[model samples]
Target: MQSLDERCLRYLAEAVGCGSVRAAADKLNVNASAVSRQIVQMEGQLATPLIERHRRGVRATPAGSLLLDYYRRQASDREDILAKLTELKGLRRGHIDVVLGEGFVGDLMSGLLQGFWARHPDLTMTLDLAATNDVVRRVVEDEAHLGLVYNPPPEPRLRTHLAMPHPIRLLVRADHPLAAHPGPVRLADLAGHRLGTMHPAYGIRQIIAAAERAEGVRLDPVLITGSIGVLKQFVASGIGVTLLPAFCAAQEISAGSLVALPLADPGLDGVEAQIVTRLGRQLSPAAGTLLQHLARGMAGEARSGTRRSSSSR
Candidate 1:
């Protein structure tokens, strides 16, 4: 818990994130009137309105953005001080907040989290699973120490540390017809077959759409979902075939339950998985340690993927 003034700042940040006073109050476990009063008092203290209220909800004014930046810096500075103190005590205590894309929340994350906790027994950690854009936003806002994203966009405020170009692969059941192919699958081969995939907002979906266009074929999908797990289930049930990054189905691929056929398209190969951090912010010792671990883990996944693919023959 923070001091009263700091708590007020937290309320402001939450309000900005939520975009509603009532929603922020619900999250903060306080009455809406109290939350409104705190904001009003903060406005008075600063001699300016930090947020502009509208019928839809509220948004930060110029002053609010500035204050939020200062607040984030203060929170970061506190962490840095604690990191130094922990270093003086032999790195016995630290904490890091990481935001990851939903695709990363499965076995890969479980293994990473388990290994990290075991490796750093005295350190605490927080993990948030969100959409790709949300993960990027959290890191850019300084709310998260690190972010893992798929096909990240150009953001001047953020810097990519590890860009792993994970070529999209065709994911299908072991008994599926595509499984007969010994090498990479081309886009035109699937023109008449049913396809299952995520919505267009996802990077994978965008990649698939572009591939379909270049192949000059249009196959209406049998299933269009927002969850990769759902797509995997549908594919398992013989509903349709789908495209996924190698890491997305690593467990099944390794177990021989699912087959990942490489996509032999030039455009599809540019889709990348990246780890990112804020441009000028040097991560604390704890965060920096985890970032390196994650990078190594991802690289290991890629290498193991090559070994698995080659041995499957």
Candidate 2:
């Protein structure tokens, strides 16, 4: 067999990623026939079929999966090499892709991004907001360099760089009745109150569900949404109380518009926010530095929360 063509390899990777040659062509701004031709050439070079089509879309054959994996690693390694060369020139220039849950956006912007960007002005970063599962998938697939998730499930392919306790709290307007609860609020106490919650895709919702099961209760939220902003607005408008980490509503709580109360449920009390990367993957220098900054910032946030809790006591 002849040496494989890089362009053909890229076409194959994109086709598999998009699940169709037409979709890949649309993404790459090329003709579908051109993309298909490249993939066919690649298959001929390898002497094996690269993709199998079904009703839903296309999937890689076992051999195709191996080739795709090799393509991803090669792409990542090339980036690493370029980053190292930039570092050798004393230039802080490289792009870092981060996939994270929407809940982390406020803290990331307020606590980390600006300062990091100021110090490494030549560097570029992309932040993509996704659900917990998508965040993990992107990191594991080499599509992103880092992930910030809340209470993510255990995955062997990921490494946790930092995990900070940011347990679920009952969020309500200051004048709401639950705000005056003397201690941790129990699930039973939430009875007869209006409830708003995120859609099940969110980590907070999953934690809330588990807690409800453990305590043998069910919460039927009047409002269910995929947006954290929507949930915050729902509470602020006095529509109902919602469950979230204290830091998620830090600004509102500090401004006295919303109050975050502890939950009595053990499962909710143990939730954490984590920063993760692909296990065994070497990070670019810029990405590594930003990770350190994020870890420190997150630690500081946790410390601040501790101080606030102590002072309240």
Candidate 3:
């Protein structure tokens, strides 16, 4: 027997998703009648009515919903197989999609990917900068090949590797009053201090908030911005002090451009960086090689004290 074509499976899946034959046809750029006939034929082959019709639209029957899920999974598996085959050609080509959190796009990801590019010059990479939840969602849905996230997502279909742990610290200009503080600073010490941080949606923000709450302190941030780079600039200009990962503060701290001090008591222990992908997503040959390179880099960083945690690979 001949195998089912991808287009047919795709049509069925889309029809189920849209719940209307006409809508699926529009999405697929085909005639409504064609989608209708194909779905009817598919149902006939299965010997069941796959959908329930209504005046406004159609909805998938129990059987239709199951079939749609199966089709989608099969499509994802087929793509993985194709990606693997392409890698075996040793051509070092094909795009790798990465979803990363805001601050992650800077030093860590930049350094790791720079080395990767040097080795696989022909491979293309696309990075999507977003919040942690967004990154995990993309990876879980197989919309991205890999994800760099601060917080691990809890999903049975996903696996995570601890790439590194970033030692987070409070940063300020050299002349900031807190820069001269000697011992463990109490959270109450920051009562009137101008705090700058990311939106509460980011994991780091939650970590910061929890620390403050534990000390019975409530911060009145003078600035709340999403961009870490911009926050660094604000701190450098003496606008306000902010907490940031050490790696992100490295260059400025080394250049005498900023002073990063560890917060005492509930110190910014660090943010855990994780590499997440679908549990069984077959990586392309190039992707596999890059993953190994990243693992090595993480190991090296951990050894050098540049990163806080060892590889959880």
| All-Cα superposition RMSD per candidate | 3.7, 1.9, 5.3
User: In candidate 2, how many clashes are counted?
Assistant: 0
The 0-to-1 C-alpha lDDT of every candidate, in the order given, reads 0.82, 0.88, 0.74
Model 2 TM-score, all chains together: 0.93
Give one digit per residue, the lDDT tens place, for model 3 in 1-313: 4455556667777776687888999998999999888878777777778788898788888987776666757766777678787867774667777788766665555488788887788988788887777777778767787887775546787787555776567788889999887865665777777888888877678778788878778888889987888889999888888877766666788688788776774545745777777787777666667667766776676676543324321
lDDT of 1 by residue, 109-175 (tens): 6587778778888988888877777777889888899998888767998899888878888988999
**TM of each candidate vs. truth:** 0.84, 0.93, 0.77
Whole-model alpha-carbon lDDT for candidate 2: 0.88
TM-score of 1: 0.84
Residue 301 lDDT in model 3? 66
Clashing pairs in 1: none
Candidate 3 Cα misplacement greater than 4 A, ranges: 1-72, 108-111, 265-267, 306-313
* Winner of 1 and 2 under lDDT: 2
Per-residue lDDT of 12 in model 1: 92
